[model samples]
Target: MKKITCPLRWILFLFCFPVVGSYVCAQDSVSVLFIGNSYTYVNDLPGTFGALAANLGKELTIDSKTNGGYTFQNHTTDPLTYSKIHSKPWDVVVIQGQSQEPSFPDVQVNTQTLPYAMQLSDSIWANNPCSNVMYYMTWGRQNGDSQWSEINTFEKMNTRLYHAYMRMADSSDRAMVSPVGRVWSYVRANYPLINLYNADESHPSLEGTYLAACTFYTSLFRESPSGSDYHPGIGAGEAWVLQNAAAAVILDSLDHFHLHPVDEPTQASFTLVQNGDTIQLTNTSSRATTYTWDFGDGQSAITEDAQHTFGGNGIYNVQLIASSSCNTDTFSIQVTTLGVHDHLFDGIKVKTSDEFIELTSSGGTFLIRTFSIDGKLLTEQSLSNKNPLMISRINQFQVLHLTDSGGFEKVIRIF
Candidate 1:
């Protein structure tokens, strides 16, 4: 039996096109610091990200200044906390208040606390310059926890806290909020078994820890390694996807690559006759825009899709910059050549607009003469003439060629 295959173009069209969504790439390694309470420390929360990054061929290190029950106030007063941010460089510092801070009615808990986190964030940025700070918005406590009794409702408290943190991040623009709390809500809506609490119903279980890892990974890295096929086990594919997603997310988030539309080809592939030695450029962007071509020659630029000839051999860089109102992009290529020596003074052609009739060479100078088939002198001129020198004006065209100052001739025209 024979196997059948789908066309590659169709496959590429389906998978390669950009969707409305955006993702951050984590190509480079990341140094992360988690600043929080047991919610962050218990069950080795930071290791999950490190483990996942490793799966994706990334080296991720998670260090922290954590206390078992530290709140935003504790972190502000803790000398050890300040020391960690300054000790070494960090890519991101994850900061959060006590999970119950949002449940308070005074709102000053969040208002006062966010500033301290931001202060720490600023210090980190001042030190690292390129580091990003993220606030981890934790989930609501168990349905009947004592912390919620005075908060009126767990749901309302979590929502307000989430929004408070979001507002703080938005105002500063120096921090990003990872929506793990939202994902936790999303998972709980579908899966009743996803609750983290043991029978005591206060803390999370192994399953709960895994869920937290997934939420953090997805929001922070823009992809969840577990995918839609999520289950309880922590094995091969799950681990690999999680780690790679972390690397991809972190890398992409930091380095931005602005792209211009690719020049449309006459076809997916093209062939050019070797003589003309020019590649015609086209605007393939959806909108019309101006283009500038730097044919990689250290020469002047041309504004049109004109033909060019190479004088010698080797690779040359060709660069093009195109711009639209929305964005601008650049493209470059190196044109390599087979360097064989030859002289065109023997039989070269020239049948272009008079404005483009200049000869360039690396050797001897050239003179030009025009004549009829009957040897009647039509026009004779100095080959070195660099002005508006007119040639034959006959209607019945024949052949004309170019000659060197030494009288060697090349057929410049055959018509």
Candidate 2:
């Protein structure tokens, strides 16, 4: 007597599902929502990130809905997530999948992660045209994904994870990747003493969560967290280390994560001259309408050409960010300053032209050393009986160390 109908079945499904609360929109503040599973909730990433932002004097409204071991497919099918996405004018919506889902083979990723990511991104944009969808690129398991033969080693799994998240971000217009996994890779490789994983090797430890929070801070604010006062209950020393690590990997190269501010390409270039403790910055950028400069001494400027005075003598990493409506570029240089009376290398005159570094000394053998701003040595040479040694420009900017045979040394900035 009763005929089973497809429409009736769908209605029953909707009725049986649990109701998710509607997210209220906020005004005059940055608002973000996190959607994922245990990886996002274990250490309370959203809360920690909010605290970090607060410590930086920024107001961020943060929310999250996470379930244990839930995948993107689950989120796509869940009515609560759908309601949340469609209910608010969110500034950002962060999405992360099951830890193992992204490490699967390409076919599996296409069949599973890609489709769900596209759906979520579409929902985010459809609901709030100005909202940004950030895909949280999670790290591989501490040891590896043993359940799958294709992802047995950490390197293998991480490689696959990187490609998967990149693919997802590239496929959508409003999507960008957080590259939290890449940050983990950097920490593990460089800071082996810092353990990011818990005993289970999958969930993040407090330090790991702190790093993630720092990454989020940089991504959302488009500024480095190096000077933030928040430590999130961790020791100040360790917090500083984590903050710098995140900045070095994320803020230094936003393009690696496809997190540039705009879609059109732009370049950041600048030259600076130090007069005593005051430095004047000249912006030489292309295809840019806005400029932001971080003087690397807890000071920042927004003018096209800015001048800043330092209080002490030390090396500072100065960053210049140039942006257009759809794209951004970054350039950085290290500025070293000394007192007016200090002369380490007396008689060593340095001049820079468009293409070469012109150096003149008092007719003796001198050792020339060049280094990147990050303190990496790039070139080393000894000049003997040369009146004016001309070295081609190695990079946009570098530090040149000149040491005379008599043991006198001088450090100069080449721009």
Highest lDDT against the true fold, candidate = 2
> What TM-score would every model get versus the actual structure?
0.48, 0.59
Query: For every model in order, what is the number of clashing pairs?
Result: 15, 3
How close to the true structure is residue 142 of candidate 2, measured as C-alpha lDDT?
82
Model 2 scores a C-alpha lDDT of 0.75
Q: Write the per-residue lDDT of candidate 2 for residues 1-415, one digit (tens) a residue.
A: 1111122433344355432222322333877888887678766788788878887877767777776667888999998888767656877889998888888877777887789888988888778655778899899778787767767777788878987887787676526688888888888898888889876777788999999998888877778888877876678888888888888888866754656552333567776655446777777664467899999999998999998998999889999998865467789987877755335444566666544777776666789888887898877887655656778763644677777766866666666
Instruction: Superpose all Cα atoms of candidate 2 onto the true structure and report the RMSD in Å to 1 decimal.
Output: 13.2
Runs in model 1 lying further than 4 Å from the true structure: 1-28, 144-152, 227-415
RMSD of each: 23.9, 13.2
lDDT tens per residue, model 1, 91-146? 66778776666445545644656667667766766666545667777766656334
Which regions in candidate 2 have their CA more than 4 angstroms from the true location? 1-28, 261-415
